[model samples]
Target: MTWTDDDPGQGEPPAILGLAKLRTARAQEIRRAQDTLTTASGDAGVGWQAQSQTAFAAEVQKTAGDVELLAVGMEKQAAVLTQYAGQLSQLKDRQRILEQRRASAKSSLARANAMMPGGLFSEPTPAPFVLAGEEDSTAEAKAEEEARQRAAAESKIAAAQADLRAIESEWDALVADRRRVDQSCSTALEAADILGAVSSFSGSAVSAASPGDLLDRLSVLSAIDLQVLLAAHPELAEKLQAASTQDVATWWNALDAEHQQTFIVGLPNIIGSLNGVSALGRVAANRINAANRLEAIERTLADWKRQAAQPGSFTNATSQISALEDEIKYLRGAVSEPPTVQLYLYDKDADRIIEMIGTPSPETKRVVTYTPGTLANLDGFYSGDTQSIADWLHKRDEDGMVAFVVKDGRYPQNPLTEANDQQYARGIAQNLADFEEVAFTDPLLEGRQSVAIGHSWGVANITVSEALGAHYDKVVSLSGAGAPADWTPSPTTEYRDFSYDDILQFAQDIRVGEHGAVWSGRNPREVGFAHEDYYDAPLTWKSFPGNGLVNPLLAAAGGIESHNLAASTAPGNLTLLNDMRDFINEAGAPR
Candidate 1:
């Protein structure tokens, strides 16, 4: 393989050089063809590799496009689900309102039925008559007829009561259904983030994450959601703020169980445009506004219900507001100015009347006190002569200074509602406090009598009656309540000396032979106390109609009937000393 640089390979022959030249020329041609072939092969391999790579890239891009389309479809479906859920929730709310109305009607119907007559009696049987008077068959026949009449009445009462009970049961079932629907709506609202605020700038990331991931990221949505909620449902939002730690824990627990899986599996791709500009914000705002307006309208409708129940309220309001200017002479029928009642404050400290009616009572005596439950207003005093048993014994004597300790306490016409009960309770409590403040400031009432008389639910005022330490004397309830179900004692009984029969009987005894004191005249029913036994048992049988006497005015007063009776018995301003003294002694005395 060693070759000389020069010298013609050491000895070149002319003929041989010619032969080698030919051979070399042929080899050079062969080598050129091989090089050309190699280059062509290399170029073809490079082109094939590039084409394969292009095809692979197309396949990857197609796969990505399919995935994006699937994500879009999922998002659309989620939106539709949200909309349908909202619609269902609204429907449920409407159903609840309808059910509430039905329930109210049913309750009224049941109450009416319970009040019907005969249901209050026990089954009638033949009676034993006196031997001397029973000799005649005619007398026995008359007795049999009376018994038949009584039985008929009893049957009618029973039928009415049964109907009422059936209606009430149906009403109860409907109420239960209403509650279920309300709960379902609440659940749906929670999932839809009804109260949650959507931020235009940074919307929920839940839309983007899988359902599981969304649950993990819900905390991220909490702050904005809360803001949105406050703007949407102010009342509910306020409640949310006041919710206890336990409530929040419960809410979170329930929420986690309900939507955790859905959020995680479908959130991310679903959250494509997670900004406020999206449908979530708009839908949330619209739904919240609708709900709020619906609630407000419902409240308005409830107000109308009161008007419907008592046409008198509407009538009074109309007359008062219109000043009776549009009424014809006949319609205005002998209109007379109602005397204005004034609350006089007798300052025990100054020994003078400090303020007149429309003013706070004067804090005088050693125990300054204001007694309610009677015709409270000195001006608007009740003139009727149906006196409470207390009044018969307690009103002033013949001598002006020797008058009994009786005072006319005004009670305006006011209906009893849940809201009314709460308001009245608060008013009475505050008024009691006011009395204490006066006592402290004045020297006269230092050791005087401090007492408050609440007639009906006004008995609730007893809750704050003893604000004056031991200064209070006696709290007498005329016709007080028993327990609603009678499984236990009356709720307000522990707070006062409860009595109905005693007061009624006492009232009867005091007016036995007095002038303007006839039992029939004193009772709105015009039935003498001697005959009350015949009514009491039947009236007490169930809960409605002839069983319970009806006096619209008394119902409005909502206090013990005796207090109003006292005011009615007294013709003018008179002392209630006799009544108060008697009641104090006989608070628990036997009938």
Candidate 2:
């Protein structure tokens, strides 16, 4: 029970001490069993009992080996407990020192007050001494000088008391910290003891095999074999799925590039979609799967072309070929060479990417994610307008890094039909929120201001995400369609922009039953939610006064065009972008 800095058992609780003793006992028992087995195996035996004795000895040796491993693990757990206990002791000692210093400060302040002329609490008073036969002017001058000196002395006393109070406050904080540390140490010791006991029977034992051997075997497993392994041991898969991102990243980095490629290639489905897998790993796995898909599609297209050329082919191979060609083009574009920006979290199937025009690392002061409206797809995600908006933000604030992401949600082939589906918006919101969670978890992106820009359907998605408790510093909805009736934007700075002539807002009004049965739910513009601000864009024709004479005839056209003007790189949209940027910067300003 004696404590020492170097002693592994020092400062450990009684429970840990008991576990340590048990481990020692088990180690000795294992050693004895091993020795007896060795002796029996070497002994010259005869008859049928020899075979039985040898088998029994082998079983005993195996059991002893497992027990020895368990004992070693328990010993490590005990050492961990002892280390935590040592930390607790040191914290307690520091706490005592701070308390002593605070007490000394208090005593010094008391002594300082005693040494003062009157008392620390006494008010200043003029001296009683008055010169006899002296003029009144002289007496008044002496009284004024005495009063000034007393005031100075009182100020010094007050400063000394303030310093002592500050010291006492610091000491109190230190004591609170010490208590927390002590509790944490206690919890650690208890956890270690419990885990140690569980470890003894937790079925974690592997045949004395090297980890490299297991990895090598895994590297050669086929997709079916891997799936079977997953099916057979889902608990292990669950553990891998729940591991921290850093841990998964570490594991992924340890493998050589070739092995990493092979491992993921063999089990792309699992690795690509597995939660808790590092973004880097997911990107790599998805890239492989994307390539495989492209190759498969190309082969199919080649086959179709060959069939279409054959004589008397009754099937309409032309349409099939056209569809495949379009798909190939889109897929190729998605994983195309020389990417325009840094891509993170790319899922070809879902066509969602947490991309960045500028680095979204910790060094970046601001990170903005832009969700595009209806008909947005990977093929058109990097259009000129998208790049222009990203460039505008980056140029506007040279000191800050801005990333515009098009987190396209799943939509049907015909987007118009799915535009009002709240369920679709909710699903997209979940995806965006999950991406945010993963992004913020990175040490480099921690605490950075995050803004979400939603255009058309994106507005609904972002709104729903916020309502679902997604965190955003600022949200800007451009021509938002509507939101669920019961949903409200999360507590954050929100901005809404709508064109005065935009027919889409009017159309959404009809869809949401605002003018007539609520279609969607509530138009964000009419929701009465206290938004930070709203921008109303003029619906003038791009030509303006030049087309004024015929503007009335083109009014509908101008309005229809204005719906997209807010989010576009069109000259007229510059005002909206500037206003949005101002709002974003204002919201992020220090309170």
The model with the greatest TM-score is 2
Q: Which ten residues in a row have the lowest lDDT in candidate 2?
A: 197-206
Task: Please write out the lDDT profile of model 1 over residues 1-591, one tens digit for every residue.
Answer: 121222112222344335435544544554555445445444545446766665655544433443333333334334443444444345445445545655665565555444334333333445556577556875677667666666665566566566657655755554454455445544543443322223221223323334333323344543324333334334432333343333333333454422422222223221211111112221223223323434554555455555757855643344322322221111121122321211122211222111111111233221213233322332222221222332333332221111012231223244223312334344444544444433332222233344434443333333333322212444543332111111222222222333333233333334434421211223311221111121121122122343336663443233233334433334421333333444444333111
Question: Which portions of model 1 miss their true places by more than 4 Å?
Answer: 1-318, 321-342, 345-416, 419-424, 465-471, 480-498, 501-580, 585-591
Q: Which residue pairs clash in candidate 2? A: 362-444, 512-519
Q: Per model, how many backbone clashes are there?
A: 63, 2
- TM-scores, all models, native as reference: 0.24, 0.50
Question: CA shift at 202, candidate 2, in angstroms?
Answer: 17
Tens-digit lDDT track of model 2 for 5-54: 22222343455556656756755675676677777776646664877877
> Whole-model Cα lDDT per candidate?
0.34, 0.60
Worst 10 residues of 1 by lDDT: 397-406
- lDDT measured at residue 1 in model 2 versus the true structure, 0 to 100: 31
Per-candidate RMSD, Å: 41.6, 26.0
